[model samples]
Target chain A: MNSSANSTMPIANRTVFFVSDGTGITAETFGHSVLTQFDMKFKQVRLPFIDTLDKAHEAVRKINEAFEKEGARPIVFSTLVKTDLAKVIFASKGMHMDLIQTFVSPLEQELGVKSTHTIGRSHNVADTEEYKNRIEAINFSLAHDDGQSDKNLSTADVILVGVSRSGKTPTSLYLAMQYGIKAANYPLIPEDFERGKLPSCLPAYKHKLFGLSILPERLSEIRNERRPGSKYASLENCRYEVNEAEALMRKEGIRWLSSTAKSIEEISTTILQEIKADVRIY
Target chain B: MNSSANSTMPIANRTVFFVSDGTGITAETFGHSVLTQFDMKFKQVRLPFIDTLDKAHEAVRKINEAFEKEGARPIVFSTLVKTDLAKVIFASKGMHMDLIQTFVSPLEQELGVKSTHTIGRSHNVADTEEYKNRIEAINFSLAHDDGQSDKNLSTADVILVGVSRSGKTPTSLYLAMQYGIKAANYPLIPEDFERGKLPSCLPAYKHKLFGLSILPERLSEIRNERRPGSKYASLENCRYEVNEAEALMRKEGIRWLSSTAKSIEEISTTILQEIKADVRIY
Candidate 1:
């Protein structure tokens, strides 16, 4: 009665690294970055809390058994080695297992920091009220905002207006998730330009506004890729659009950030700081 | 009566950069990375696909006008300077503007790679069908997957089961987003252990089933943080759950991953790869 007998079991051959105090997001983020560097197969699991000391011992025992049964050393990534938990895992340290601990001992020595408490790095970011708010805001915005055309969004916590592909989606997502703010974004479409004005939905929340603009040449090149041989993808149209967009942004008095040379994280975080909004989640 | 009228133009106090050959994501990525290094205020815009000559001219004209209106030297991040657009922007280059072009002249000089034809970096990644499919799959999964608890998921493309807080939500989201798969996850509740059995719902999709295990000590410590002084968060209970869960995973032949040290990205990608599912978007 193998649990994987009926399902696709596509994850059978891959190794996964899951590190968490209990909630797995923090460890997962770091794990993902490391995983991206490799072209190998793997999977992830984040077990946030075991709920007991005996549970720690049980986990160690299972690790040893799984290793013996599989006949291969699975890669184990772990963090938050509390003394009681560490003792259990230490017993199974080298019995047919390859372990990669992300809360590296080397990192501790390099950073000149040590904690008597071993609650893993995942808990570090969560310990901040400010950080919590921002992440929550980011989630909130994602949940609340709709990326639909013709949706009325007059009541947004922050309204991001930018030309197409100006890092609005990620920025807004980040804001909503990190800050728990209800963020909405509107692309200043070509139609808006033809009419010589900002989209009507924008002015209703004009005061809580920001813009993202990129260099026109950059815009033209991006559009060219999508519609290779059309006037819409023409450099002239790009220039016209960029120019008009800037003029409109200025005319509408919407302050903007140039996506030209900024990362989504930076753009989102900076806007959050400037607006001085309440960014703490819980 | 412009909406921005009440606000002091933040443009003067901020720097803005725009980089493109068109469809601005690539330039924007680099732009974001570089700008992240600086502690400054900036805005962004992205215009993609600027192949025609006239558009380039107009972009520069508008940029020049923006400089005057803002009364500041704008920092322009750009790429693919066709002669016509270059001429227009060049007017602002020395006086009221500073431009950083991503399509480096030095790159051509150093690598001996010359292109009369304009191109972008994103095109390289987008050109491959496999890569495109993967991206598409990931996008599709993201749209469809909501990362909620599923009660009737016996027909899941994949099912992740683990103790509470075992990197389930993010991993599920990653699978859905990156592979366009319908993944569902169910928690191993305490009641299952009290009865010494796997959840009833799991056996049906047993083939596609998976387990996520973590060091019990890590798990215990994690749980302790949330509910201190309870036996549920005690070492003994943790040991019981760990041992029982492992036995359950082993007895049922549900492959389990130790999410002790890995990031979520690593875990998810690894799982995806192990399952031999290509990344895709719907």
Candidate 2:
């Protein structure tokens, strides 16, 4: 199930640690993907903000403890930047996966220069102009969420249209949070469907429109969780809304996909491809 | 500038590509982290959703084009699961950095099992219970946002309190999106200061409370951008709000941090550490 630390298992097949000078999010994210390849669950621990020599040594202690308890070398995925910190962690009693250091030497040789080896450089905040732009994008997306404002519709990178609970809000927030793209979402409610047209305000920004449709069964389950035993959560009404929404999207020539089975990442990536949104790599 | 593809560089010192059979986000994220170790900025391109042979070959062609144009071997970071597709891309005229495959074999040896090697297994979406929990957490955070409701206040994993523009909203959203933490945020306005205490509703949830403070100068600048020339945007008002908010937090023994110089990731990670939120590894 990929649930964290199954207690009943007592001893996990392997122990894993995501160590980083910053948040262990990146280390855990990539390491989790690598581990997903193997159909085995790891007893995972996240040791973040290990920016100091003492903290690095402390991390080594934790890693060694896990290795001894598990009776095998733990898997350590680290993004620690300081060479001294890296050396300390690499010497731990675990199969250390240094995400950053492995490539730094090769990259240094290729670029003919010394590596910065700067910890926490990857997530510098609003101090950088680019980071500030990301903040603005988040604000824009929030202000314009749920068709809240049309004054700045012209500025949006992509405007998502979908039936209620058809996975619009989370997707829009992800675009803003993850990619710094201004995303505004609108729910294709019964009113829009009865009009036999796309939302009147959306026509002017037709090219930027992306639609997310969902299977009736999944839509019903998701909605029923929010408002149970209501007509809005009924399969019949969900079917109607989905059909009409798809019809409107098809007629209006807006690119669309059924998001019933897609993750937010997959949906966002597809939208970026279709809208040709400028990829802003942080 | 870290901007993509500086044309004025004529031929960039190096060209880099993040190629993946999925969104390429994972590839780009780690690749970017590794690249940040070097001081030089390279021309960058992302080739995502390269699942088919045609798309895989297309990626190779693009990588070759960048190599030819840059007059240097490009660096390719890939997470493609299919061996045939990876073979095609790796054989291109660039230095290949397969993020997934590099560690896959080692992980296999450690786990003593053959990898499923499933493409897109990392983000299986709402089909999985964990992913559904993420969606529920996002919806929960959105509903409980800005202290909108106290009905579910006890259910919240963390309740963030701060003055306006202290970055509570985006931080909450990031926690929900990235880590599935049920975060609720509240803004400590002049009214709360006038009352000379924490919000009445927050006392019971003191154990779950986290506060964010900001530099008055930065707060004033951020608020001014939203509400130009208003008293709320004035530095004096911002100073009063921040001082009062921090005082309230200190009096309540609520753990807090200044968000003025932190990214949303940094802020969220700090909150997680303080709140002891159960780590959900997806």
Q: Compute the DockQ of candidate 2.
A: 0.48
Clashing pairs in 2: none
DockQ of model 1, rounded to 2 decimals: 0.03
Model 1 Cα lDDT, one tens digit per residue, B4-106 = 0112222223334443444333333333322322223244544444456666665565566656766665455454435455555556531222111322343
**Candidate 2: residue B96 Cα off by (Å):** 0.8
Task: Give the distance in Å from residue A114's predicted Cα in candidate 1 to where it truly belongs.
Answer: 18
Tens-place lDDT per residue, model 2, B24-71, is 877877787887776555667778888999998898898889788778
Span of ten consecutive residues with least summed lDDT in model 2 chain A: A1-10
On residues A161-275, what C-alpha lDDT tens digit does candidate 2 reach at each position? 9998888899998888777788999878889888988778999999888899999999999889889999999999999999999998989998899998888888988887787
Candidate 1 lDDT by residue in tens digits, A10-116: 23333343433433333333333223222232433334454357766666665666557555443444443455665565566322111113223432342233523
TM-score of each: 0.42, 0.95
After superposition, which runs of candidate 2 have C-alpha atoms over 4 Å from their true positions?
A1-11, A278-282, B1-13, B278-282
Worst 10 residues of 1 chain A by lDDT: A1-10
